[model samples]
Target: MTSVTPGVPERQAARPASMPVRCPSQVCDLDVLPDGVVVTDATGVVTAVNSRALAILGADRDAVLGADARVALPLQDLEGRSWWTCADPYGGLATRTRISETLLALPGDREVFLTATLGRERPRGPVVQVVVVLRAAAARRRAEQKTSALISTVAHELRSPLTSVKGFTSTLLRRWDRFSDDQKRLMLETIESDTDRITRLVAELLDVSRIDSGRLELRRQPVDLPRIVERHVEGLVASGHAADRFVLQVQEPLPEVWADPDRVEQVVANLMENALRHGAGVVTVAIAGSPGQDFLLVRVSDEGEGIPEESYPMVFTRFWHSTRRGGTGLGLYVVRGLVQAHGGTISVGRAPCGGAEFCFTLPAGAPEHVA
Candidate 1:
């Protein structure tokens, strides 16, 4: 590896026990820093190196101590000069400067792109200390790339629903007198469905933001599990899905759940919607509770091709999609967030019918009073 600082002296002074040594300047403890830290004396000899710095250099603490700082990190500026040489023009002033896009050539021909910040402590003192902080260049680039991709995906997903709503409403408005009552109803329903799709997409996006920021909100209350599942199935039927398509099997005298009713409905609805769109055969919603159990179990299963076992781990990841069409890929992610927010757990597996089964548990609430 290329060495940036000058050769180490034969007899080096004893290194200080603490960083910044007795200087009046405030100094951050290198040991507590998350990033790699390398501290050097005025003559450019490695005096102190943190554990993280040793890991980055692939060397032991003893190997780097008393060595030339330049050889350990081997940082070179864009102009092909040692970083220390480039900073030498500053004449030992106490200043903090960042060297962007610097190349660090390590042993074994491995190179890492880094941005190094160079700071001096007590520049005018008899003994000046230089501190260098290093960060990976690829990390910042990856974050920028992810942000760009999310924006593009959101815009693309929003366009289709917006176009459908606009077209259906415009046609209904202009050709109102020519349509029959049935035709008018169908058009209005189609528009409403498209509008709902838009709303769902927007809500999923917002939920993702909230989940990422650890700010997801849940209004918890005593919820009747059977009633919520039945209502969701009824709504699906009213939306033109066959009533027979859904099968709800609930154990008698099931306990109430302590959860958010609206969020519970959303979880069931998203799962059933997934089944209808991607699964085949009967979609069954089953609820049961054991006498000694503290939680109620709800399972939504379908009789279609089940997800591969290896893919189960990624099913709940944000923006993950099995197919190109349908969904903003946030339904299951948001569902998991909402469920966990209420102190519940959700999982996916193969149903008895050889298809996807989503099972979740909710904490049981107090017994209901029959008045």
Candidate 2:
């Protein structure tokens, strides 16, 4: 399905023709389409059916080609009603020249996405032809499942923190003098921390939206990569992580790369958090310039059982889940989008210590004004 950007209205003009081509001959040999195509005559007889259509419906070519489409098609709704009888393209209103895409079940609990064009001789005239398009439902179904998962995950994750915030605030207001100063301070601090978590989750959702919609914007400035890494590590250590658990190294004479400072810091924090949460033992982060000409590099690695090489492709996909704890799985996706927006590339590999490794490079980009 095509996403129409918000605030952009579709043009209003004369009635538009369906599917760019209408005749039976034009769509007959349309095995060229990655999707299945089926055409029917005015009397509702199946005139042409492509190989894909046969494969999807599990119908024999000889049996399907000449049969009445109403009987030949094996699709049914959730109520087990025949699709043709319910839709009734031939008997439906002449103004309805097409069927919007709909999901219908086939035999054996399988499903297909179907859309059709009802061709007529003139405006509101008798239906002369019908062109049907079929597509496997797997990809669309997976996308819908992911969207549902995202909503469920975000709701579940937000509920805990929000409940804590409300509970703490209510307790404080109700028993202001009963608690000691230290106890009150701890309650307020907890509230603050939970608020930060909520803020971060909302920010991540917005970033994911922007990245997917091709609307992500960067405010490029010369970034001090080492300082950001140092500060992030310091915070982690202060937050009860062992100081020795992280080995940080920054090579001097780093190349000048203009990038969004906050985004770069977000990238660093996400990688470090991922390493800490998912991997075990020592975590190492190194920022350096390449030896020869210097491609600005940031490498983060951990000493844990390395990720399987086969899993690399899925690491950055939206809503991808792992056995590891925490995060909405948008961190690495946002990290990659931020890196690429700066004209950079990121890769996953295995570390020397037999653990997952992530390396990203910035191509020493200048500001847009200079470019």
TM-score of each: 0.78, 0.80
Question: Which numbered prediction scores highest in TM-score against the true structure?
Answer: 2
Deviation (Å) of 364 in candidate 2 = 2.9
Lowest lDDT sum, 10 consecutive residues, model 1, at: 3-12
RMSD of 1: 5.5
How does residue 132 of candidate 2 score in lDDT?
A: 88
Q: lDDT tens string, model 1, 285-338? A: 999986766788889999989788998999997667765356677789998998
What range of 10 consecutive residues in model 2 has the weakest lDDT sum?
3-12
How close is each model in CA RMSD to the real structure? Answer: 5.5, 8.5
Off by over 4 Å in 1: 1-33, 77-82, 87-127, 137-142, 166-190, 365-371
Candidate 2: which stretches are off by over 4 Å?
Answer: 1-35, 45-55, 58-68, 237-244, 291-294, 305-313, 318-324, 367-370
